[model samples]
Target: MTPEELTRPWPPPTPKPAERGAPPTPVPSAVPRRRLLRWAAVGAILVLLVWSVQGTGVSVGALIDGREGGLHLVRGFLHPDLSAAFLADVGSAVLQTVQISLTGLLLAAPLGLAGALLIAGNVGAPGWLRGSARAGAAFLRGVPDLLWALLFVATIGPGPAAGALAIAVHGAGLLAKLGAEQLEAIDPAPVEAVRLTGTGRAATAVLAIIPQARAGLASLLLYQWECNLRTSTVIGFVGAGGIGQELAISLRLFRYDELSTLILAVLAMILLVDQLSRVIRRRMGAAT
Candidate 1:
């Protein structure tokens, strides 16, 4: 070997293809100040929540006390009096409650649909008209069912009519909100297609939107029906007719036996309605 070749320095190895034109990847840093602040805030909130709950006397002891009281009360309800007059009165009261809920729900459906249509952007009427409808629905919804029942009781005198009207008002508002949501979520393409066929807005809604929204609408209606049943029981508090008045009277008299009977009856009614609603909902799902 020549002395010049022996003196030459060795060359460094070539870089990989991936590393040739690539920029240096930045290294990940530690958690930022914002993240630390967030964790601190969360810890502070948890501390405040625990303190507030304890300060307000909302403790495990309160729950235990409530459970004990309920158990004691339930003991008296174990035996029920089966007098003929009492049974008849209960039957009549239950029938009255059913009538109130059904009548109210029926009256509410059309009004709620109209309100929903007016509030929905795709099928709303004139701007001011739509605004009025939405305002009416909001007003009705904001008022509690009990308040409406009391108001109707004052106006119409204590009876089933008052109770029915109260349920109608609240039910209409709730149904309107749900129905409007359903209407808004409907397929707009169908609506446009119907319009292209020279159909009017009302006609387009009837043909296009209603068909698609019918399932949700029906479900909402059944849900309202279930709710109204529960509401009807309480409307009797204002003397607007139902089993609730009798239950209240029995409680006032400390007739725990009779009260138990009423409670059981109400429980049965609720379970029945729930089962019926479930069946109908399933059928609706199948149809769709």
Candidate 2:
């Protein structure tokens, strides 16, 4: 109202409480070169992924179109044929499968252990012997299981015996390879101690080294058994005589219900072996 007040210049507006004592806005630093490259790579990957999905025609619509067949399978699973006849057939098949796997496992143990010891140079075997064993194990492992089964079938005819031999030969090589690795990783102190006492190589292994690696060897053996169990069914498809033979026959006849039953039986056997292996491994751990 006064002339002096009107002549005074207007003052700058006061900052709000929230803005008081705040630092000035800062400029963003340049991103690192590596970070930019990473982001670029990630974007490229995403583009490729999207293009692949589209190229493959993988979409919700395709899944929906396939649901009818899936539903039919689910329905058969829900009402699996559990009749006496079915059970009897499944039981016989299961027995044959188990027999083949068991026989193979039994055969693999001695062969695999011998092969492992032969390959692990600590046993004082001749260099030639070790090399020979290594080559033999590699050869067996290199050949596919189906080919082994076919080879045996040609000589022994299409039966459980052929299946057993096939799985045995294949499983032995795997077990030996894994077992030798375990042996190599064992502490050398015990082996050295036995050697200092004038023990023979075989005696030292039996007394000291073998005990240390026993649990691992057992795990390898049980793992091979599990593999052989699964392989037994596959070999049966080639007329080796097991549930897979029945499965092939059922599939050929389009007997969905019977197929479901066979699948359930196989699943049961797998679970049983799984539980058994777990129990055995636990016992081995406790013993060690």
Query: In TM-score terms, which candidate is top?
Result: 1
In candidate 2, what residue range of length 10 has the lowest lDDT sum? 12-21
- Distance from true position, residue 137, model 2, in Å? 1.6
Clashes of 1: 0
- Pairing residues by index, what is the TM-score of model 2? 0.76
Best by lDDT: 1
Instruction: Tell me the spans in candidate 2 whose CA falls farther than 4 Å from its real position.
Output: 1-68
- Give the TM-scores of the predictions, in the order they appear: 0.81, 0.76
Question: How many Å off is the CA of 116 in candidate 2?
Answer: 0.3
Cand. 1 TM to true fold: 0.81
